[model samples]
Target: MNLLLVEDDLDLGNGVRIALANQGMDVVWVRRLDDALRTLDGGTFDMVLLDLGLPDGDGLDLLFRLRRDRQILPVLVLSARDALNDRLRSLDDGADDYLVKPFALAELLSRVRALARRSYGFNDETIRMRGLALHEPTRGVIVDGEPVELSRCEFDLLALLLKRTGRVVTRRVMEEQVLPGGQANGSNSLEVHISNLRKKIGQGYIRTVRGIGYVIDVQSLARSTQK
Candidate 1:
């Protein structure tokens, strides 16, 4: 998943980014609320990790603007304010969850997963498409009851494709979700990942749409498995 992390504390931000990246999430970190708002307006993210204490402005005001504009991206606030009013204010401003400073990384990850599940209307950690099952918590994939070993990037790419099965996921979208800040990796990098994934999942499962992008044929995958 693509996540925007708005935090002013350099050490904390770096730690959280590394932790989330290890968990197969692409995160873009910004220190100021203005930068966060700019990124939010210009880019696509599955969720936001916002810190209330920003150098430029309060995170709650940013949340308020997002809510006012009807931006439905899941937001989880992180703050040093552990008081009842502060927590309630953040929730009232449209934060999906709140975490006080000195929180555990595991707890933060759990809350993120829960919010994502609610947004996707899924109650379980495993996402099943056709005969391919992806276990988010464990970072495992099983195809046709057989475990499939994948590189980190390959797993992330496949997860994004499977999540939006049947839809033509543009290269830009895939890049954003698979790579942080949509960094300038060569164009062929994505293709290489797709090729590697195809070798593992079977050739016909993922279709390249020429200049457009790629799509996962979930129905065809099911039929092939049945046959």
Candidate 2:
């Protein structure tokens, strides 16, 4: 999962970022409301961990802007405002979930996972595609009941592809989400990774769409599994 964390406190932000990354989430942290807005405008994340207080402006203003623009991405407010009215106002203004400061990290991770499942419509943490299974929590992949060894990038790529099975995932989208910090790779690194992934999982499962992108053929996977 990819998450955008908007927080001004350096210590908290760094701690949360490390924790979330350890949980297999790609987290991008920004300290200011303007930076948060800019990150939102450019990147796609599974969820937003927003602090109600930001350096540039109130985080609620950013939330209001997102709602006004009809952005449906899940936003979970993380703030020190522990008033009943604060929580109510946040939900009313379009925040999906609210967590007060000095909370348990485990609880925060649970909430983030819940928001991710809700936003992505994932019924479970494990994704099954025919004989292939990608378990998000374990960071493990299995094919035909056998473990398949894959690098971190390969697993992330396969997980993304499985989530969007049968649809062509655009090159730009893949690069942004699968790459580190949405950085552009000048080399053919993506292709190299994809090629390695195909070699491990079987080339028939993934198909390149010529100039567009790549796709995981669910139907083809089903057919192959049945045979």
In model 1, which range of ten residues has the least summed lDDT? 218-227
Tens digits of per-residue lDDT for model 2, 87-180: 9999999999999998888999999878766654454578777688888889998888999999988999998887666556777888887877
**Per-prediction backbone clash count:** 0, 0
Write down the TM-score of every candidate. 0.60, 0.62
C-alpha root-mean-square deviation, each candidate: 7.4, 6.9
- Candidate 2, superposed: residue stretches over 4 Å from native: 127-171, 175-227
* Candidate 2 global CA lDDT score: 0.82
Q: How big is the positional error of residue 100 in model 1, measured in Å on the Cα after superposition?
A: 0.7
**What shift in Å separates residue 178 of candidate 1 from its native position after superposition?**
11
Highest TM-score: give the candidate number: 2
Model 2: residue 37 alpha-carbon error in angstroms: 1.0
TM for candidate 1 is: 0.60
